[model samples]
Every structure is written in C-alpha cells, then in structure tokens.
Target: MKVRIGVGHVPVGAHDPAAGLAELADELEAHRVDSVWLSDLASAPHTVDPLIGLAYIAGRTRRLKLGTGVLILPGRDPAVVAMQLAGLAALAPGRVLPTFGIRPAQPADRPAYAVPPGRHAEVFEEALTVVRALLSRPNVTHHGEFFHLDEVSIAPLPAKPLDLWLSGRLPAALDRVGRLADGWLGSNITSGEAEACRVRIERAAADAGREIEPDHYGTYLTVVLDDADERAVGALLDGIRRRRPDGADPRTLVCRGWAAAREEMRRFVDAGLTKFVVRPAAPVTSRRDFLDQFVAELGPMET
Candidate 1:
C-alpha cells in the first residue's frame, strides 16, 4: 500500500493569526509536507479565514497544496463558496483543494444555515451538483430543493475546477462521498472506523455504476516528539483530555516517542490510508521543532 504524509493546523486559542500562520506555513514548506490543511470553526480565536490564510501562504510557498480539512458547507451559499474556491484555484493553480463538510445543527442565534436534520446527505449531494455545474458552465441555472442559481458564471475560471472533498462520519455521508466528491476528509477517527467507512464508499460507487477511483482518505492525528521531557508529554496529554474527555486514551492517541509513532504509522499504512495530516498537541510552542521531529521519524517510511 502507498501512503502520503501531510500537515494540519488547529487554530485553537490562537492569539495572532498572521504570526501563527506565517510560522506554520514556513514550517510546512520547509518540511516539504504534501499539503497544509486548515479547519473551519465558528468559535475559534485568532482564526484567520481559511481561504485568505491559504492565499497568504500561497504567496510564500512554492509547492505545498493548500486545503481545508473541512469547510462546513451549510453555513455558506454554495455559489459563494464556488466562486471563492474557483478564484483561489486560479490564483494558486494546482495548489488548492476545497474540502466541504455538512455541519450539525447550530443555535438559533448563530448564522442562519439550512441543513435539515437527518438530511445532510441529500443536502450535500444537491449542493455539490449545483456548485459543480456553476463552476463548469458559463451560464448555469439551477432550481434545486435547497438552492437556486440563475444564469451565473464566475469569471477567470480556475486553472482547473476545484477538487471537491466531503467530510462526515455517517454511512450516508460516506455513500455521498462515493457518488459526488473527489475525496473524503475527516479527523479524530481511528483506522478501523476509517476502513469501514472506505468500504461503504467504494461499494456505493460500484453500485452506482461509477468506476470512480477510491477517493482520497485523509485524517488528522496529533503528533508529539518522543525525546521531549515528561513535562512536555504531560502537557500534551492534558490538552487532549481537555478537548475530548470521552475519546480514546489520550496517551494512545498521541504519537509520542518517534519509534513508537512510526509503528503506529505502519498500521495506518496497512489500513489503506493515503495521507496522514499531522498536527501537534497543545502547548506546542515551536512549530518547527515538532515538524523537524516528524520529518526525522517519517523519513525512513516515505515511499
């Protein structure tokens, strides 16, 4: 099996978007990571807009693909997102991948987004269809259940139509990915869960008489340097516990001690994952430090 490695950013409690992203982008390019992924969170502090951040990084880097780990689709109009992604792709050319996701319900006070309950699969499928049509056609009009487009055309068409990805955990979402998306993007899921999801997606595509190649499967994992002091490890574990008290054992989830982490990577490789987006644990003061350690550990495993 082949495996690719990438890097992800978590804008948790960030205080300075410009400084943080500048540092992170430099580290990612320096490490030669395949992609740099940003998350979309309504509550994140010091969070730079994902597309703007990617554009900034694009000007600074030469090769790293700029991507969104999951851009919640329901929160924004599909046409608006299509235009933004298409513009970004035109500016970056072969360096942008827009990964769209269906968000769960939000409070009434929150922005008005229309993803009906239990209908994320249907909504996402329809939304993708509309977005793709608008991007690929000069004068596109559509009247869908959730969205309506009237003779719209985005100018300076992307060097190529943006590669779309879907993010979700349910079987319905997996099936939708098989039918509509260029790839599947997710996080905090174990290899076992991912493998099962992959099976569903492949089967769904086969049933549709679509011989689509397996959509790219990508997951974000927290990385911790092994040679670091016990205090460092403790801080990392504590952060994980704070974020997910009910999730897997924090220690097990953290890829600590380079040798042990490499072993874990091997397991994921065996499970057919194409890419690993490594994000450092909390209290990670030095982005380069963690990335350097990851490169040292991952170098031997590279195909």
Candidate 2:
C-alpha cells in the first residue's frame, strides 16, 4: 500500500487568514506534505468555511492537494456543491480531494446541517447521487425525496472525475460507504477498529458489486505533543471522554508525542490503512514549529 500523510486544519490561530494560509501552503509544499485538509464547522468562530478556504488555498499553492477533511453534505444544495467541487477540481486538477459526512461533528452545530427528519442517510445517498450526476454529465435530471433537478449540469468539469470520499464508523455508515462512496475516511477509532471497519466496507462493497481502492482508506489522527500545556491536554481528554464509546478509555485514541504518533501510523499501516490526516490534539503555539516537528517525525514514515 502507498502510505500518504496530510495535514488536518492547523489549530494555531492566525491573525491574517490569507497570509497564514499562504505560508502554510508554501511550507507544506516545501516539505512535500501530501495534502492539507479543513474540517467543517459552520458555527465555530474563526474557522474557515472548508470550501472557500480550499478555493483560496488552491490559488496560493500548486502542489499541495486540497481537501475537506469532511464537509457536511446532507444539508447543502447538491447542485451547488457539485459546482463548487467542480470549480476546485478544474482549478487544481488532480489535487482536489473531497470527503463528506452526513452530519456535523458538534451537536450544537447539527441543526445547521438540516436534513428531512428521519431520513438523513437516505438524503445523503440521494444527494451524492445528484452531485455525481451533475459533475459528470450534461443536462442531468434527478428527482428524489429531498432534491429535484432537471437538465442541470456543471460546466468545465475536472479533466478526470473527482473521487468522493466519506467518513463514518457505524455499520450503516460503512454500508453506505461501500455502496456509494469512492473511499472511506474514519476518525476517533483505534487501529483494530479501523482494520475491522475496512473489512466491513470491503465486504459490503463486494456484496454491492463495488470495490473501493485499497489505498483509499484513511483516518484522522489526533496527536498531543509532550510539550502541550495542561489546558490543551485536559481539553483533548475531556472532549474525547464525552465522545468515547462506553467503557473505552479516551487515552487509547490519541497519540501522546511525535514518536507515539509515528508508531500509531505504523500500526495503522499494518492494518491496511494507507492515508492519514494528522491534526494536533490541541492548538499549537506555532504552526511552523508544529509542522517542522511533524515532518521530522513522520516525513520519512511515508512511502
């Protein structure tokens, strides 16, 4: 398997978004980091809208692949999303990597990602269908429970179709990925769990007569450096505790230092997961420092 590493949204606060993003793009490209990802957070203060941020980053850098660690897909208009992604893909060519999820990560933000009551999965699947149709064909027509379209198409499509990835851990979600998603991007799960999840997705894909690329599987790893302050460490633990499954230790899901993070990636590679988007568990004092340490530790690990 080809192991590739990408950066999740940098947690360090930037006084100037444009300059900061430009610097980030330059550094990541210089380091030859595989990609850069932005998480979706409609209500979070100072968080860049994933799509808009990616568009700006696309203009600032040539080699760094742009990704939405995951943008919430169910609520947005599929046609618009299709066009937006199409635009990004057209601009960046092979560098646009879009992964979507059905719901926002934070509970307080869920309401903003509105879907018809009791039909989230259905809506998500249909919305993806509409998006795929619009991205590839002209004068497309789609009529579904949550969306309706007629003779709608996005022009100047990507030279190659963009691979649509998805994130989810539940059985139903894995099934959905196998049936519909081009790949999977999991988070907050152990290597054992990730291995099992990959098997499940592949099985479901086989049952559905589909096959996800082996190297397309990836996950977001939250790492807390040894030098992280108490508040940062405590906040990471507390958030994970609240989100952890019953009886599961929150500590088991996080990497404690660069060494541990590297070891964890090796474990994941052994489990057949090849792509990674590693995010600092808490905000860093310096994005450049964190990235420098990140490359020193994990750069050689990529194959």
Best TM-score among the predictions, by candidate number: 2
Which pairs clash inside model 1?
A: 226-257
Tens-place lDDT per residue, model 1, 195-277, is 88777887887887764454277666776644445675686667556545466667777676667667777776666666677
Local distance difference test values of all predictions, in order? 0.72, 0.87
Clash count for each candidate, listed in order shown: 1, 0
**How far does residue 79 in candidate 1 sit from its true spot (Å)?**
0.7
- Which ten residues in a row are the worst by lDDT in model 2? 11-20
The all-Cα superposition gives candidate 1 an RMSD in Å to the true structure of 3.6
Question: For each candidate, what TM-score against the reference?
Answer: 0.85, 0.96
lDDT at 294, model 2: 85
Model 2: per-residue Cα lDDT over 106-197, one tens digit each: 88888988787888888899999998888888779988888898788788977888899999989999998999989999988999999999
State, as a TM-score between 0 and 1, how close model 1 is to the true structure. 0.85
Q: In model 1, what lDDT does residue 239 have? A: 58
